[model samples]
Target chain A: MIGTLILVVCCLLSTERLIIHAPRPGRLRTPDLITLRSDQRFAQLKAVLPTTGVLGYVEAPGTVNAAHYYLAQYALAPLVVDYSPQHALVVGNFFADSPPDLSPNLLLIKDFGDGVLLLANKDVR
Target chain B: MAVALAAFLCFASGFALVSLFSSGTVPDASAVLFNLTLSAGFGLGIFSLAFFLARIFAISNIIAVDAAVLVCLIAALLLARNASASTNLLMFSPGADEQWPRWLRRILVAATSLALCGALYAAIMQALAHPQGGGWDAFAIWNLHARFLFLAGSHWRDGFSSLIPWSHPDYPLLVPAAIANFWTFIGHDDPHVPAAVGLLLTFAAVGLLFSSLSMLRGRVAAMLASLTLLATPFFIEQGTWQYADIPLAFFFLATIALLAVSDEQSLARGSSSSGFLALAGITAGFAGWTKNEGVLFVCGIILARQIVFLRAGRKRSEINPSFHRHSSAFLLGCAPVILLIIYCKHRLAPPGDLFTSPASMLHRLLEPFRFEIVVKAFLRRFFSFGGWLGIPGTVLLLAFYFIVGRGQRRGLPAGHRASILALFLTFIGYFCVYLITPYDLFWHLRFSLDRLFLQLWPSTVFLFFLLITPQKLPLSSNVSR
Candidate 1:
């Protein structure tokens, strides 16, 4: 019994050691950040966000161009953005849009190059 | 003929080296050589088998078994020299019994040979009946890359045309590129090589799983697991179709083997268990390299390992060093393929209309809770076994579950429980992903659920046998006698 147990242990130990010592093939190292095209930026943003977070970005041409829908499905956060700078179009799903309308504490942040971003807390206006 | 000769040499050399060094006090030079040779045989045997079968069946335009054989040889040398103790589960079996009945002892050897022959035959038939364009995903994604590699030549790197962000580009090119390289060598582009290669690898995955389980648990458990996977309707179907699921299954089985080794080592003093843990990490990383779903699987494993470690009451300081090392090793193994996937999505492929913008996330979050769709899709995937051999297998799964749940088997190890938990978590993760998908959930479920189930089938069946099979089974007696 002890012999069988020792054999099993040795085999397991040796295999494990082999895996750790083995040189990994085809491993790539990338910088923390890479510059993305406007559309690619949107894809990156969608890829990074949590499933429940809402993303509200304007859909104007050359502004916030959404590219990969499948990637965005996992990025299912609500987005409320003004597509055209001329129009204050607060477009988003019911939950995100409703919270701003219902609360006095919410405030619209300054417009970035593409569109206005929103900031809100229940305690602050 | 040369290809067959090369494969024979690889196997013979590997077996001889293993036999030569298996009993030595220090497993340094000979052990390393044995591992390298065996891995080479394992990889090349599968690769050549795919190509040889493809050529015989006339499914592919290209025929360069020699190139694949060469690649296998190179890979073997590389793996042997750079080999780690962690991934050595390939060699981790109970000591062989020379005194056992020849018939009983030879069953696995025979089964393995038969399975390889069957895979080779299937590859030939698949090659002969090769489709003009690529099959669905082959044409849509995997083969498209192969097409670009062959046609674009030096500019093949420029073929990252798909805008599907999630459909990773820079993924490992070991399988697909190997196929394309063969095609290039033979002066003809043939996607069937890779497709068939995928099938043969799946067979290897099944074979390894069977052989390992048979050695560790018992013959019955191993046979059940292997036969169940082979007979799985969806598994067999997907084996024919060139998909990433089988490879992922291979990685999954690899992870289980590593864990099993680690567990066995834990019970024995002077054993190095961390090495298996590290190998498990590497295999898990490869699983991620195979597909986007693999990333989620990695997350699941990390979480599972954390849970197991904490439950074992290992101190944070002691555990942290080992955990960090394993994680780094895993990342080192996985990083290249992951980077390629990222590069493909960000730089190469055209962006699609899927969730590219922040607003898309909102739309998708609500999509899964579409009650009617979720229920219908779940039901279809869970119950529908019409085309595949799922009906009988599903019945067996249920029976196994029920029988095992009754606690017929005693002394189940903690590692076994952890693995079962990990499997459950994986199933839930996949299930939730399907639920949340923005597309036609029902159709997606019908298409993929069975294949998804195949990923866990081998492990599940093995666990089932472990629980239900009587301790005094006849096989054990036969072996002892």
Candidate 2:
């Protein structure tokens, strides 16, 4: 009787947890919006982005989504992600509500909304 | 269409290699499932090997890889076509030995089915929640490395540059290589691929536990064991999290399953063939190839087995159960992957972050504080690691064995006991790593301890079920392909 109860309780609780998080089966065909949005957000900027060299990535130091740096790097691979905002072309992921203060020499080339900004460093070597 | 053909070729190559190495020729559900799982792993091995060679030769196209894989597949299939019939055939008959009441059996089955349904839902939900995976390590490390491999073409080496030390490029490439192989076939990276792979490994681990145990133990034991694994919330989540932990768990379970079968065969036959032991060794070697921790498991398992034999005080003898023969056969199986791992560590990859600076490591090891933290963490996670929902699964499982007490034999064979001791040894090995780690000790433990426990959890369940199982085997059951 105790064995049955243990199994029953475990089965029910695990199932409940899964059901709460389970997405509609239909939505599976739709790839994650993270990738989709990243692609859409970077679609036009890809042309101006360097075809063969390292791309720079800069973000506010303590934002929750430091992951956007890696995702942007992933979506636009073949280009190295240099986290230091030292390169001529740097991806400024201002994931917070407002953009971060930066060197005046750096100019905003594109704003892919929702705080995804592309900044070009004017002080290029 | 081309991708379909490539996948088929990959499966064929793996299937052929497994069929060749397999001890049991009879095609039972468990045997077929185990063989298919092995094939998938071996197929990935073939792809990684060819891709690694392709890089050295400055060749990085789909056509070159497809041709090589096809040739290898066909050759392996043809050469091993006439391999002899299995000396032992394993069949699944739920109540072959003793009879449980019909209502009891039905209840057990219903409970197992519900647990399985729960597991499936969790895995699906996880995949849907983050098609790219939810954890920091997924996108940041594994998938990121795969992007480097697939998108960077010949310049894949750029990913291992010393600049991005956080990526841990020195880590073995099994998970990344498998994902990259699938992407190369499809012609572009897909976020769904990792999700799918994660789910596959997750379910595959359960399948492996069920099938192997059912054949070796019985249906009741198998169901309860698999249910324990399936009901673990973290196991399901980590499976879809696109981390190496689940994959490493699969390989660990495979090693234990193979070794258990080999031990069973040796007990049954006066002299067992080395086929199963060889396969166990190979699986152990694959474990080493999967993660750095796997290398420790391989060594720990072997060391534990030797220690058991040494303590037994057996005289040296030329016989079927001779410790020397079995150990040597196991080593023979591990040789190929061991070589590949050595080459990868010495030649292709960057220095591993852990244990890189000996002076600092020595300093850290000498510090008495590190040992206290790790021990406390180990004990904390030990009770909590099952990832159960309401109550911890481990607590319930312990209640299970205690209530089910002595209804059947629960003691283990010498070999199975060695496997259990090896697991404990591996835990000790993990402790040693925690002691010497270069990273901030708490941070490393916070992120990784649960997973390290998870890697051994399934195998622990397998062992627990093995002991509690009724050990009477019925001879000459009808076989099904």
Q: Which has the greatest DockQ?
A: 2
The estimated TM-scores of all candidates read 0.58, 0.89
**Candidate 1 fraction of reference contacts recovered:** 0.00
- Residue-wise C-alpha lDDT for candidate 1, range B141-172, written one tens digit per residue: 55545544554433444444332333345443
List candidate 1 segments past 4 Å from native.
Answer: A1-125, B1-127, B130-134, B163-174, B273-275, B314-355, B367-372, B385-390, B404-407, B466-481
What would the per-residue lDDT of candidate 2 be over residues B1-481, giving only the tens digit for each residue?
Answer: 8567666766776666666566346756767777777677666656656666666577867556757776865676556554554444444344542555567667778877987887787677668867878776887688888888877777887777655537777877777877787788888887877887788778888888987887887766777788788878888888888898888898888888888887776665545567667777877887887789999999988898888767653532322456678888889988888888898788778888887999988888889999999999998887787656667777776777787745755445667878999999998988988999988899999989999999999999998888877664634443323
Residue pairs in collision within model 2: none
Position B224, candidate 2: lDDT? 75
**Backbone clash numbers for all candidates listed:** 49, 0
List model 2 lDDT by residue over A27-70, tens digit each: 67774667667766666666677654676777776773656776
Q: For each candidate, what's the DockQ?
A: 0.01, 0.45
